[model samples]
Target: MAGRLYLVPAWLSEDAPVESVLPTTVLERIRTLNDFVVEDAKSARRFLTACGHPGPMRDVAMKELNEHTAARDVPDLLEAVRAGRDVGLLSEAGVPAVADPGSLLVAAAHAEGIAVVPLSGPSSIVLALMASGLEGQRFRFLGYLPADASERTKAILELEKRSARERETQVFIETPYRNDALFASLLESCRPGTRIAIAVDLTGPEESVRMQAVEAWRRKPATIGKRPATFLLLA
Candidate 1:
């Protein structure tokens, strides 16, 4: 039997009543997934507990699919199929493999002839672009930025150049703690008129997407810093 792989969206807290899920419909669909593979084990368990679906959470049937294991253990996930289990790949929040730690497993599953299933749901990249008031038709999600400050700045310079030449929406993210630093770097590095969007705590009550000039951003107080967030840049 072909192993079934489900890509479930983690947009809101399981205990969250309603308002937290931007569009009510997104949460409606999430209720159906019976099993999940989380990027953070502790968080995943907390989510399950909030959803009123806590189970034995057997170790044999579950795993953490985060950066710690995505590269080295992706192939091992296929054994789940051999074991006759329909598995789900989840993340700490939002969509999996979209800057999350599920891409390796996705590639492995396809290579091994495992069925890939994606559930329609929220994507911070798309949501940020949509709300940014920027051109959404042509966009590229750059995922996360480099760890080193100088390297990250260099990457930003290159990407800004790419955006100018190609008329593309360049999107990327940074570690929660470095949000302020990245934001500052972008403001200082990019051109004054460069249009940028930052989506923070998307889909939750704290959700916000800021779109404005790089210079303009520096004038205003920083809106996000070291929080779960994503960013989008448009030329």
Candidate 2:
């Protein structure tokens, strides 16, 4: 039988300790996996160390899987699992394959009939949605919005309309550095009464999740700076 493919989740914030966000059981299973496909090998190594991996760091096997990884090269990363050696798939943060590049590897594992198991851990997206006070029954995660200002504004407007028409909540994320610009576009493009939720620094000491009308937000504008944040809109 082919070895299993484990989808391991990382902590929401780099500043957080592994024990705080991940259960002991998951960390123990992680230590047993020798091969890994990760968004950043260096970061994965650091995470493993923090989780109390017993082996020497140099002995662990890891392969890079990020935006720079080519589609044609994805299949090669799963060879170890196909050969009956369990492999772990880890992301830079949060869950693997959820808005992360590891999804390609997961797809390849499924295509090859490998058993993929997802371990429980902190997810900034799900954490944000659960705390946003928005309609959780029906919602959509739009991933990262367009980089261009005009296109982003257009997307904000379209998602807002969808929220109102379907009574669904819209969730999205931004590069920490571009969070300010995205917040501005949301305030400017969304209707005044449309509800907006901002969840920032999730699973960190300074975590904040607030919900308010766009009009109210205009009165007391917030500067998100470079903190990671998730935005939810319900119209």
Best-fitting candidate, scored by lDDT? 2
RMSD of 2: 1.0
lDDT of each: 0.73, 0.93
Model 1 spans with C-alpha error above 4 angstroms: 12-36, 58-60, 70-72, 221-223
Q: Rate residue 185 of model 1 by lDDT.
A: 86
Per-prediction TM-score to the true structure, in the order listed: 0.83, 0.97
Total backbone collisions, model 1: 2
Among all windows of 10 consecutive residues in model 1, the one with the lowest summed lDDT is 13-22
Per-residue lDDT tens digits for candidate 1, residues 1-235, read: 7658878666543434433443354344334445556688787766544444435545324577776773766788667665666777877876788877688888988888888888666677777788888777788887778988899889999999999898988988787898988888898889988988888876666777778888788788575865677788876
lDDT by residue for model 2 over 44-161, one digit each (tens)?
A: 9988888888869899999999999999999999999988999999999999999987889999988988999999999988999999999999999989999999999889889999
Error of 2 at 222 (Å): 1.0
Where does candidate 2 clash, by residue pair?
none
